[model samples]
Structures are given as C-alpha cells and as structure tokens.
Target: MERRKGTIVNVGSITALAPGPWAGVYSASKAALHALSDSLRVELKSFGINVMTVAPGGTKSNLGNSSAAKYDQTHDWKYYKKYEEGLRARTEISQGPGSTPAEELAKKVVASVLKKNPPAWFAYGQFSAILSVLYYAPLWFRDYFYRLVMKC
Candidate 1:
C-alpha cells in the first residue's frame, strides 16, 4: 500500500540564502544543514539513501510567536539596545500577512517527497523565490537590501 525509502529530509529555511540582521544564528544553522544535506545526498547515494533539503520561507507557524516570546525575555541589549524594536519585528517577519499557509507547504513537500524520483533540493513558501534569487545577488546588494528591510 505504501513505499518508503531511506530518505532524510532536512527542513531548512529560506533565510539561509540571505542572512538578515537579527536572525544570524537561525540563518547560519539552516545554512549549515543545507551544506550537510548537499554532501549527504551524494555520500548516501551508493547506500540507497536519499537526502532532501526543504527550504521554507514565510510559512504560517508558531515559530514567530515563540521567537517573540523568547525575544520578550531578553532585556539586556547593551550596544544594540537602540534597535530593540527592529529586532523584535524580525521575529514576526515569517508570520506576516503574506505568509504561506502551513497546509499548502506541507502538501507540496509531501507530493515532492512521494515521487518515484524525489528531488535533492526543494524550496517553497512566501519569500522562497525571491530569496533563491537573492542567493545569486552580489554581496553588497544583498547587504544593502537587508539593512533597508531589517532597519539595521
């Protein structure tokens, strides 16, 4: 009734492609996962294992609320105290009005993963396309764009 292989799906983030001002650690972690998945896709191929990386953008989830709650707990900003509001706003960036519905993203992921020949890389959600494009943009341009949007 069902067929399942040894597939490893790493849930990455579109943020990995473009590191923003207040989300350094989150972006870095996702970027690291992307790198790991890339390597594993090849390394595990001979063993009949497939690795897929899903890079989701602003999809509807409780992550924004959780991030906000965590940010609320931190009071010591020191040198970065003046930009607290912007930092807080960054927490809710993925949960904005334009955010993708979680169900939609789930459906896409499931459909892709269930295919006979699954893809090695997949990205979906609100800012997915733009962020993918941003991956190819110049460093200076990306920096200016992030600074303008994140208000850093």
Candidate 2:
C-alpha cells in the first residue's frame, strides 16, 4: 500500500463493526477490511497515498438478497432455527425501506475519491453508526447488547 500514491477506498460494512444474526461471514469480511484500513492508513500516509475506509449502511442492493448459501427454511443450522424469525428480520434490513439509494452512495464515494482532502473514513446510511460503536466496544458489552436487542 505504501509503494504507490493513490486513493484506496476500502468498502466496509455495518457488519464489520457489529456482527449480528445470519451474517457472520459477511460481517467478518467487512471487519477485516476495516482493520486492514486501520493498518494501511498509517503505513501509506507518509507516501501521499490516501487509504480511506467507507462503511455503507442499509441500501437496496442484491448483495444480501443473494448470500452464500440459500438454504430452504426447512433445512437450517440446528440452534439457529430457534432464532429463525430474528434472522429473517435482520436479513431484511439490507433491503428495507430506509435503504439509501445505491447510486447515491456511489456518487458520494466517487466524490470522496476526488476530494482535495478525502476523509480518513466515511460511513453512510443506517447501521454504519452502530458498527462504529461495535468496533470500539468491549467484547462482553457487544455480546450482551446483541442479546438484549435481539431478545435471544
């Protein structure tokens, strides 16, 4: 990352900060990007290379509609079935009405890349805020909070 001089907008997600029901893998992947950005920023800052991390919130897109495994409701993880309704509800969030238009996000992203002084990290939309907190919270705090919020 330090070898070149250019802007790198790493696409993170609310999942990275807050890992919740039915999307552990997705969240972890995004979280990895966030962590990577944290390291890369310092490593590349002196070289005039801007490494920014953008965490997008809920937006209407096909990303979640098509997940890793589209297993039928009849066949699911044993313990997970107990929280099936909650899982479905959480999954629906990405496609919910509050979703920021994808184009809107893309436009902002492009503008950020073209900025004279781009932000170190940019988070847009709903869950992005929660994820930021989760990224800084204690382990017990995050776990208990999730349990209380989901009632599971």
lDDT of 1 by residue, 19-90 (tens): 878888999999999999999998888777889999998988898889888755676757667887788779
Off by over 4 Å in 1: 1-5
TM-scores, all models, native as reference? 0.91, 0.81
lDDT (tens digit, per residue) of candidate 2 on 22-141 = 678888898898999999998988888988999889987886576423534445468676786666667667788878889999998898889988998888987777867887999898
- Highest TM-score against the true fold, candidate: 1
Which portions of model 2 miss their true places by more than 4 Å?
Answer: 1-4, 73-78, 134-141
Local accuracy by lDDT, each model: 0.87, 0.79
Q: What local lDDT score does residue 54 receive in model 2, on the 0 to 100 scale?
A: 90
